[model samples]
Target: MSGEPLPPVKRVVIVGGGTAGWMTAAALSRLTDAGVAVTLIESEEIGTVGVGEATIPSLLDFNRYLGIDEDAFMAATGATFKLGIEFVDWADRGDRYLHPFGIHGRDVHGVKFHQIWLRQSRLAGRMGQVGNVSDYCLANQAAASGRFTRPVPDPAAVLSSFSYAFHFDASLYARFLRGLAEEAGVQRIEGKIVHVDIASDDGCIRAVELADGRRAEGELFIDCSGFRSLLLGDALGVPFTSWQHWLPCDRAVAVPSASTSAPLPYTRATADSAGWRWRIPLQHRVGNGHVYASAFIDDDEATAKILDNLDAPPLDAPRPLRFTAGVRERLWERNCIAIGLAGGFLEPLESTSIHLIQSGITRLMSLFPDTGPAIAERKEYNRLLRQEYEQVRDFVILHYHRTNRTDSDFWNYCRTMAIPTTLEDKIALWRAKGRIIRDQGGLFSDDSWIAVLMGQGLIPQSHDPLADALPIEEAGRFLDHLRDVIARTAAAMPRHIDFIASHCRSDLAA
Candidate 1:
């Protein structure tokens, strides 16, 4: 097997044309410098599912790799900086919390900061003065204050401790990337795929037949065909695995609304009777959606729920989408690789849709294969992506299952549903002792789990023994000083809207 290297790939073909397709195309276009030909096929008649998107901080790395200017990208997408997600009523009615982007206070002498804070909170006298854990998070405080600023390079700076993502128009982001991808020599074909021809010998995709009878062939095929999974599922016959029993929300109704005020620096997810509502603020409009289990709530009620909860008048009629909360049994099959919805979905609850796409592309690039047999590469790719999806799946399910809501059947089912053993183990560890063990390559950090666990009223029975190393009096003083520093730093930043206006205001917004 090690005698000689396989031939290099010369042509790459991508199916579909939304955020996933364009992102893949744009990223792979760099290979054009080495004479690899990249082509993308899509139909104008097909519409994309994303209305507005909330992203995580990892996108910054992807943009940097693509050489995208922050200001230019924001302006092109009518983007608003996002520091975190504000979850309302998830734990119980009237309960709320913020899952911020960065770490919560600095760790003290190699001891986790949360352990120290948890230990301090347990003290009867210091409970009120120490304040909520949110006080120690810069991103949380800044988001609550509607402030925005880029992180500083100095790690010691309070301002540099937290990170920011974005709330933007997803279609516009795809359009922006389309321009970049095309400029970098990616060929876009305007047509729908009518058929996929599979080679008889290896059962690999040979070429895609278009409605107009044109055929596009390539050595490597990328399946970004959204939920259709045209190449990977349809052509290669990969089976779909459903995680609906755990994550029961199966339908969503999304709509855009006029902005009543300045855009906040975070996305909002509010728990509802049957499901939940998401409000993502962009520079030009507010994106609202209701994700509900169709078994418990009808489409009309779900749609009505979102409409009634909007802060401003509607800009258009509501759009509906249906999906199961699961991933494919195998993301990489034969010679075709699935990215985005084609691979699987864990819903947009944590704003992980776009991030998943980025993860798929990053993984593919790392294990990019040549024209010869790629069995080992394919297995590794599938393993990595499957782990990522499950990790994200467990995180998302934590939001629903940890809830105290009993007002609706949907909540009842979610609250009592059987969860994957992986999530069960995670929650068990945290409940016993305030310890968070992150799986390798997991998307969320220990801080994220801490935020949600505590936010959902799942405080542990005890703290780490090491948290007792600091004297109570000294710990209280440190907590007081850190809280004050975070509050002051956040207050010093400009308002979210003001920062965008000065740096990256879109013409539509202007």
Candidate 2:
């Protein structure tokens, strides 16, 4: 080893200022020592694509690590608790199922809970007493009843099996984080980036020239420039790999509408002819959007579909967004790291957009190069990020590929399209035996995979052989007891709106 100590990274510069940019700034500001200086530059002229965002349960960890109070954060963002996502009409015109946030029934005698349920369900089907899979899930049951409660820390508790996330106004969330980041010493600059200067000798970013004739220099750069990908794509020339062939909804029309009723503790994604529509409830309004392929439907028609399907009258004109489903060939290149929409985009099908940003932040922090960017660090970061993206891509593809909906050309194409070999193997494994291959560092758990697979109507012919080892009478009793426990626990929870009103109600003026 060299006698001289490695130099520390002194200055870090971030581009853009939406949820991604602010999230990066807030995290680094709170985590990094005073030796590092964090600065973010953004322009008021650029409008943010701030649709209502639905997140997964992992967001709780992100906030907790940053020491943010959950109730305070929710109030600032006009947020609502989310138990799970209810997918409607994906399998067939009238079919519905929930992809919940947490586990289902408790495991029995070393066999997975789902396996036991599968066996009992099969037997029940024969006896004409089959039950809806939702009854076995605490989150799904709570969601159905419009209830919400935080999970107890005790693993043995029935309520502890469930987890929760949030539905919040993205713009408000950005503003909320901006306040925190600024308080933690993140300097915010207001200007459009006119140019990105690269070091002639190393080809790394040296400084960004603002439109106001000023330049901001830094040793490291974080690109949160949304889909434009200013630093990574336009400057570094990183190539994008499009997954449109496998996942093809490329356009979305978003609008907010009046809330017609008490907000449910879940997001609703309903399938349409060309694509699907999303309904995310917030304290003040309902966020509605239709994600569809432009080839099959026009922008005007897509907007009309969204407006027509909204639960209430529009609050404003619909906004349109266009994006391709894919990520850059490498997320980290040289001294610059790309996060959020700039790194890539997978449609909010499973509401993974913000979670991807959170993951990127966490990974960057874990492999943080205090001595400046190293090739090895960049390689490992890119490798891990690629795995994360691919894992989510495969899960999203499962929803489309396994669907029985043959109602439209869109559905037909999705059902028949060739998929990644990774996804193909997963489907094959599940079909052969009810086994879900879990990704070690993946965002979605085995329960998530099981929910989507079974919710979409794919049933394995056989479960784990160990599940059958139990006597039928015993297994049936275990199943009955589990269902009863979950249902009763869910019934005792307060209504979602009541929980929010009492614990985290927004103080924002109408």
Tell me the spans in candidate 2 whose CA falls farther than 4 Å from its real position: 1-7, 31-34, 124-130
lDDT of 2 by residue, 207-301 (tens): 99998889998878999999999999999999999999988999999999998899999999999999899999999888899999987888988
TM-score versus the correct structure, for each prediction: 0.98, 0.97
Give candidate 1's whole-model lDDT.
Answer: 0.91
Q: Provide the clash count, candidate 1.
A: 0
**TM match of model 1 to true structure:** 0.98
Clashes of 2: 0
